[model samples]
Target: MPAIVVERLSKTYFTYKRPPGVWSAVKSLFRRERHEIQAVRDISFTIEEGELVGFLGPNGAGKTTTLKMLSGIIFPTSGAARVLGYVPWERHAEMQRQIALVMGQKMQLWWDLPPYESYLLLKALYEVPDDAFEKRVHELAEMLEIRHVLHTQVRRLSLGERMKCELLAALLHRPRVLFLDEPTIGLDVVSQKRIREFLREYNQRERTTILLTSHYMQDVQELAQRVLIIHHGQLIFDDTLRALVERYSPSKALHLRLEQPADAETLSRFGRIVRMDGLEAVLEVPRELVSRVASEILQSLPVYDITIEEVDIDEIIRDIFAGKREAGALVNTAGS
Candidate 1:
């Protein structure tokens, strides 16, 4: 059986509509205005044990709302979602002990207490065996490089240290499933890298199922092989990372450092120039004609150096939002 199963799951939020002005508010006291916003619309997917799936979407696209539903932080409006055979929204004790949820900006640790105290509280709450809890805490602290800071107050730690501690706190009971919502947000490069490595090691060692949501594509690229994309609360794409890249990023990038600067008209024949500054020009060339564009640029321009590269996933996604590309159509054509 799948570790996490969500079928026809939908969540609609009731938002109160308050009119502007004091008179309007007073007049509306008798009857309140409200509207239901469909945040997650009939989204269905399953996650097998040990699978790490990335949820991708723009801001206000309902990604966090879905995570909340799956983590028992909020109730869904309709449909079924089972995590390890227990309804997630029920927040059953057994289910709660087997899973963890870490939000990026939210803190699970006590602000005034030392980080270690927070873990101890969770240890009692989860009823972790004394010996097992001690071993796990030591191991996780060593792995996360937060052993020295365990006694430091949470409010005093840097963003990165606090994040590491939070991670350890969530894993104190060694959950079989993890829901990570932007767990690495707003950290320095070294801190982010450290957290990423720690997560990879944890996943490999525990074979724990992870469902992560992040606004930063770098996090998704580094950790998840399967990605589910949602737009406007709708499941728009579900596929392997390679498949998503192949379907959406059909165009290649060509960079040229011309010995002599060229104008728009002079470079228009090769492809759409996305970046033009000084002596360098970056073009978005169709994959089919990448070689042709390269050769033509080499033969025609006073080229210093030229290279071709795959367009980054971020740009491809931007193009999709701009109506410049469609992965669904691209995938269909490729399959045919």
Candidate 2:
């Protein structure tokens, strides 16, 4: 069975918009006004066991709201969701025992105490055996290279160290399904790479199913093969990373190194010049015309070397989100 099955799961919130003035607030005391905001709109998808799926969207795209619903933190307004054969919204103990949720901005560990104490607290809460708890903590600390800082207070640790400790706390019970929302939000490049490597290794060794949401495209590119893209609270694309690039990206980049200097005017005839320097130029050409343009440039210009490559994944996805490119449903099933 799929680790997660969500069918038309949606959450709508009712909030009121009031004026800033105190007089307006007093006037509205007798008559209250409210507005409806559709946070998630009938979005549906499924994730199979052991699959690492990236959930992507812009701000206020309902990514966090959806995660909250799936993690049983908040009840959905309508539709159904099941994680590990149990309804997540029902908040069953057995189901809770097998799933974990980690939010980058939120803290589950005690601020004044060291991570060791928090781990012990979680171990007790989960009813983990004493011996098993020790073994698991040691193993995770070593894997995350955080053994040195495990005894340090949570408030004293660096951002990366705190994030690692958060992961350790969430995984102490060895949950089968993991929900990670912006796990590497503000970390540096090196820190982000470390977390990704640890998560990848853990997923492989334990066959854990993970659903990750992040604004950083590198996180998705490095970890997930399948992706679910949400836009304006709607599911827009669901497919492999390769398929997404192929279906939505319309152009390829052609980089050329000329034996002699080339002027911008001369390069413009070949294709759209994205960048130009003394003897090097980068051109953007339609996918179908890339080969033809490359051949013409080689024959017509004093070219030393030329390489054709697809557009960067981050740029392609950005254009899609900005509505510069239209990407229709690339898969028949919403989730596979």
Candidate 3:
């Protein structure tokens, strides 16, 4: 069964508009102007059990809003969603027990208290047995390599340590579904990589379904097999990362190191030149013509070594958000 199901789910926020002036503020009390902001608009998707899906979008692209709705923190204005077979906004006890939401900027752990204390409180609330709780905490702490800092005060821990503790707290009950919003934000490269490794291993070992939102393409590239991209409150694409690249990016990059120097005019005959430095050059070639172009270049030019690489996923996504590329048929309307 699917771990999460969202059908035409939407969230619209309403706020009173006020101009910057004492007179405007005073007048607004008597006559207010209400404006509607469509935070999430008729987005639909499903994540199967044990599938780790990447939820992607630029700032204000409804990524966090959608997660909040699915995690029962906020209610959607329209449509329906089910997490672990329960309507999330209903805040059912069973469903809540089986799911976890971790936002990088938010803290559930007590600021002055040690993370161990917070874990104990969570254990009590979750009704975990003493033995089971102890084992779970030890196991998770060991896995996260934070056993040395579990007793340190939350405020005293470094940002990376705090994030690891936050993740531990969220996973204490061994949730079947996890919702992570920028979990690696503000983390160092080492911390980010460690957390990614832990999440990948945990998802595989526990068979937990995860929906992760991150600005770091490396996180999605290394961890998720499928990605859902939202833009301007609408889901623009839902498919494998490979499909995302293939459909939106029609070109491949060829890096070549030549035995002899080549001028721009000579290289232009093969493909669009992206860069040239001495005997080394980077060319952009149509995906369909990459092989032929590479063969032609090798035969015609003084080629020492040549390599073909797909357009960077980061560049492809950037183009999509910048309106340089269209989603078109890549938008998965069925949302399955």
Candidate 4:
């Protein structure tokens, strides 16, 4: 059975609107105007057990709204969602016990107390057995390399240190499902890599179902093979990360080191010159014509070395989010 299932799930927020003028603000007290913001619109997908899926979108594109609905933090305005076979918005204890939501901007840790105290509180709340809790804490602390700071006040810890503690507290119960939002936000490269390694091992060993949302493309590329992209409050693409590049990216990048200096005008005949420095040049060539263009360049120009590269995943995703390209008519290859 799928670990989570959502059909036509959506959330709309209503907020009061007021004009800029003082008179308009005064008049809006008695006759107020409300605007409907569609945070999520007709979004639907299914995540099978043990699958790690990345949820992606620009700001205000509804990624966090959908996550909130799935985590039972807020109710969806319409549609149905079943997480581990339970309606999330119902706030059932059994369902709550099986899922964990971690948001980078939000904290469950007590600012003034040591993280150990917070862990104890969570242990009692989750009804975790004493022996099991001790084992889990040891394992998680060792993996996160935060054992040294467990007794330190949360407010005094560094951003990376505090994030590690937050993750430990969330996973103390060993929940079956994890909803992660920007878990690596503000973390340095080393900390981000460490966290990714921990998440990879945890998912593989425990088979935890993960739904992750992040602005960092590296996190998605390193951890998730499948990605779901949302735009304008709707799902615009759902497919393997490799397939996303193949379907949307139209050109390949060519880097060439010339035996002799060549001007921009001379390289323009082959393809669009993206950058050039001295004898080195970078060109954007159509995918289908890459080999042909490279051959012609070597035969015609003084070429020393050349390498063809696929478009960067970051660039492709940026284009998709900017509406510069659309996910064409290819069949969805996400579940496979």
Output the number of the TM-score-best candidate: 3
Q: Candidate 2 lDDT, tens digit per residue, 230-295?
A: 988889888898888878877888999999998889899988999998898999998889999999
Rank candidates by lDDT, best first: 3, 2, 4, 1
lDDT (Cα atoms) of all candidates against the true structure: 0.87, 0.91, 0.94, 0.91
Better of 3 and 4 by TM-score: 3
With a 3 Å backbone cut-off (N, CA, C), the pairs that clash in candidate 3 are: none
For residue 216, model 2's alpha carbon misses the true position, in angstroms, by: 1.1
Pick by lDDT: which candidate is best?
3
User: What TM-score goes with each of the models?
Assistant: 0.84, 0.90, 0.94, 0.88
Candidate 1 residue-wise lDDT, 1-336, digit = tens: 788988888999998888899988997897778899999988888888998889888888889999999989899988989999999989998999899999998998999999989888998998888899889999999999999999999999999999999999999998999999999889888998898898888898999999998877888889998888888887777778877777777788898999999999889888998999989999999888999879988999999999899768887776765667764523222211
TM-score of 4: 0.88
Better-scoring candidate (TM-score), 1 or 4? 4
Better of 1 and 2 by lDDT: 2
Candidate 4 per-residue lDDT over residues 163-198, each given as its tens digit: 999999999998899999989998899998988898
Report residue 93 deviation for candidate 3 (angstroms): 0.3
lDDT of 3 by residue, 269-317 (tens): 9899999999899999999999999999888988999999988899899
